[model samples]
Target chain A: MELADEAIRLADLPAADRRTIMILGHEASGIPSEALDLLDRAVEIPMVGTGHSLNVAVAGSLVLYKLAGLL
Target chain B: MELADEAIRLADLPAADRRTIMILGHEASGIPSEALDLLDRAVEIPMVGTGHSLNVAVAGSLVLYKLAGLL
Candidate 1:
């Protein structure tokens, strides 16, 4: 289990079953360090525009696609 | 300029700049046939969960990723 950064621009690794994605909540400040430490690797979706992130369902779907190699 | 069905299990085509993705709104009805007719092709992200679709942004990201050959 390795702690990997999830910052999209910086994350060069591809998504796998062992990795996790942490999209921050609007009200929450950030991911808890303890939780982050537990993740094997952190993954992110590279995005653009004024929006921060997509709705959770869509994010999860893409992650699944990445893990399943559908895209 | 060919109208294509977006049903996940049925859609075998990949996303491209010429294609479009139409995620139904929570309260809205399906895409109007006229609009569908305008789209060269309709693409869908295949999912196995009870959820029907991902948020528009995430879906869009995945579509762009496919076209860009990121995945």
Candidate 2:
């Protein structure tokens, strides 16, 4: 939350662009919807694991990789 | 290292595309240059703090923000 907020605040992006933001994770349930509203989209990554979440950097990397068209 | 490697492997990206990858942080010294060679660039974010590094997620978020042209 702090990281997202800081990124938005520091970047000073328009709300519309922020709305285009998509945060992908397996544990989307833990994140607040209001915060999701702050982003453009919030997508849950499909995964099956007793360990239900990925490291945040790994998650971010995956999302960026796809978004950057490197995937 | 594990995150980068996994991302690269899972994405099955070309080596040239991987070379464009940049890992930004305050502690570039700890990251191996060979691994960096796998990336196109490695940039160090300038900061002054007793705290040696940003959280990995935060660092990733910042890098994504800039690379995505949000910053």
Candidate 3:
């Protein structure tokens, strides 16, 4: 169990720990339950605007920037 | 001067100061020089990856979150 003991920190992990960070974009319904078994946590973005959706590439970029501590 | 003395702190301004924040989306060529005169500054997102662009809404949302201290 190479990564068995390693808990997925979700997107909440510190920027410095991103070397092994893996990102998977999924449908609005969410990452399939089966796939969730392979991961440790479901990262969620908190939104305050009236808009309820975010574009994938933009969201991806935002997460990357946040992970890199650039935002 | 209603707001003539204010400098458009650019995207670098603190999130809480967004009441007067006006964001302008434009082409890669950038905001026209004529429009630049009306704006106090040009905001920029620093990127470290090979990807050279970010989608407008995602980028906009990021700034809004940053301004609101959500990120």
Which candidate has the highest lDDT of all?
Answer: 3
For model 3, the superposed segments whose C-alpha errors exceed 4 Å read A1-13, A25-27, B1-13, B25-27, B37-41
Per-residue CA lDDT of candidate 1, range B1-71, in tens?
11235444312545455544544323234467767666555565565568755555665666665555444
Q: Over 4 Å off in model 1, which ranges?
A: A1-28, B1-29, B51-61, B64-71
The two-chain DockQ for each candidate, comma-separated, is: 0.28, 0.16, 0.35
Ranking by DockQ: 3, 1, 2
Model 3 residue A47 lDDT?
58
Global lDDT of model 1: 0.51
lDDT of 3 at B1: 6
TM-score of chain A of 2: 0.52
- Evaluated on chain B only, candidate 2 has a TM-score of 0.54
Q: How displaced is residue B61 in candidate 1, in Å?
A: 5.3
- Model 2 stretches astray by more than 4 angstroms: A1-71, B1-29
Q: Largest TM-score belongs to which candidate?
A: 3
Evaluate residue A69 in candidate 2 and report its C-alpha lDDT on the 0 to 100 scale. Answer: 40
Q: Model 2, A1-71: lDDT tens per residue?
A: 22333243322322232324555433545556565566554444333347656566755544544444433
